[model samples]
Target: MTEFRAFHNTDPPQLLKLWHAAGLGRGAAECLSIDAFEVLIFSQPYFDPNGLIVAVEDGEAVGFVLAGFGPNEEESALDYSIGIICAVIVHPNFRRRGIGRELVLRAEEYLKSKGAMNITAGPSGLLSPYLVGLYGGTRPSGFLLSDPLAAPFFESIGYDATRSIRIYQRDLLGPKPPIKFHLVNLRRKMQLMISDDYQAPNWWWLTRLGRLETLHFELVPKTGEGAVASATVIGLDLYIPKWEERVIGLTDVFVKENERSKGYGQSLLLEIARRLQDELITKLEWHVEESNTVASHVALAVGYYQIDTGIVYQLVSR
Candidate 1:
């Protein structure tokens, strides 16, 4: 008999091994580390270990599922939930036993009990009605499963592709900023631009949730004396629990249309790297719209490599 129970402190090492065997990914591997797991359990407000369910058979853990919810800024309600099925790995020996389905069902029930209005799962490409039944409908930015099996499974269950965001990373050690470009710290120059009248406050709040610091603004010069130019805000988030190699996440890099192709965006990124390198950060990471070709090109020009894709899905409960 298979029994599903809450994940406990004693389970990290074993869970890590299971995740490794499932060929999850770098992010999952990083999160599964014993130290990382402890930090997530204790420090993150949205995480609940009791919401993490593990399946055991004959005294060995064979499968697991995780769920949680957080404040929905869009709705201004604390009851909004964003359920993530961190992983649902079944021991190879336990395949074809219906264990995965049962695990998902239990996870969904747990989320509902916790007052989650909607649930999101990383679906295998293979079609499965059971997976689709979890949500009233697939969210606008639903999670994407690269695995051949997982993709169809989600589609068969009713999840559809809404949009995809591409993750990019750039190494800072190789190149230096161009000498001809003048780099100005926008944070000091554009204090007037960040007005309460605009959505700057909302952006600032969201950046805080992502643990970002060092918000910088940039301006591009235009031809006429009275002509208004393009502006952008670049923010950085430092990853915590400082390891041997520290990294910085560049979140919300935006530029106005008038400034395209003038090298301001690239210069701003270079300035950010130069500033943070003194602090010992070796890598910079950010996400961009997959469809934004110009932005993608600029990122590539600045030595950023497209690494992974993440999709966002939204669900509204009736």
Candidate 2:
């Protein structure tokens, strides 16, 4: 017999045991440290304990799932919700059971109760369909992909795959040819437009991070024209406190279609490195669509290496 319950602070040790037994130690090690998981549960904008479910068999936790609920910035009427099956480990001795599915169902129930019209899992990048349906926006936290079996498991149960993204990292201390482009210094001008009362779906995250003194921005001039054609926003995220103690994170960088091949993206990245280097930052990270060849080339030329892959999955109530 199997039963599911909410995850508690005291479940880490048991959870870790299940994680270790499932041959997922490396993946588990990266995201589920005792301290980090605790912080994730408490630090997120909407973290309901009732949304985190654990599957138990014979009084021991065999699987776990986590879900969060919040308002969708683009679709104010539809509450935004995310359900992550963070750990769905079934003891090697107890494989082929329906415990994982039950845990997922419980998580979905919790999210629905919070007024969520859709639920997505895996990586935020793969959740675009859900985001587009729920928020009418494409912004995702990151990209991730589930295992083949996992993908089918979700699909068989109603989840669909959308897009996948790869996480890339660029080492800042490497020797590279100087990037040449006309730089339009817009820090002072841009700062003037920022305010504590301004709110927008796309800019809300930026505004919140701006309040922390970690947000930075640069505007690039359009090629063949003096007008601004692109903008880049960078910030610092303390997600992985150990591996990336103070890494520079690329918040957003957009180049107009007409601005292609003008080196605007390259210039923006170089300037970001130069500015952050002045402050002693040594690492920079960003996410790129796996299908975007242009962006991939730019990233590679700038010494960035593909490190991790993630997907964002989305679902909307029909």
Best by lDDT: 2
lDDT of model 2, residue 215: 48
lDDT of each: 0.51, 0.53
Name the best candidate (by TM-score): 2
Show where candidate 2 strays beyond 4 Å.
12-33, 43-45, 74-95, 113-117, 125-158, 173-215, 219-247, 254-262, 275-282, 291-294, 314-318
Q: What tens-digit string does per-residue lDDT give for candidate 2 at 7-40? A: 7767877766665566432112333455544443
Q: Ten consecutive residues with minimal summed lDDT in candidate 2? A: 129-138
Clashes of each: 19, 12
User: Model 1: per-residue lDDT, tens digit, 24-76?
Assistant: 33333232355544443434444566777888888788877765554455524
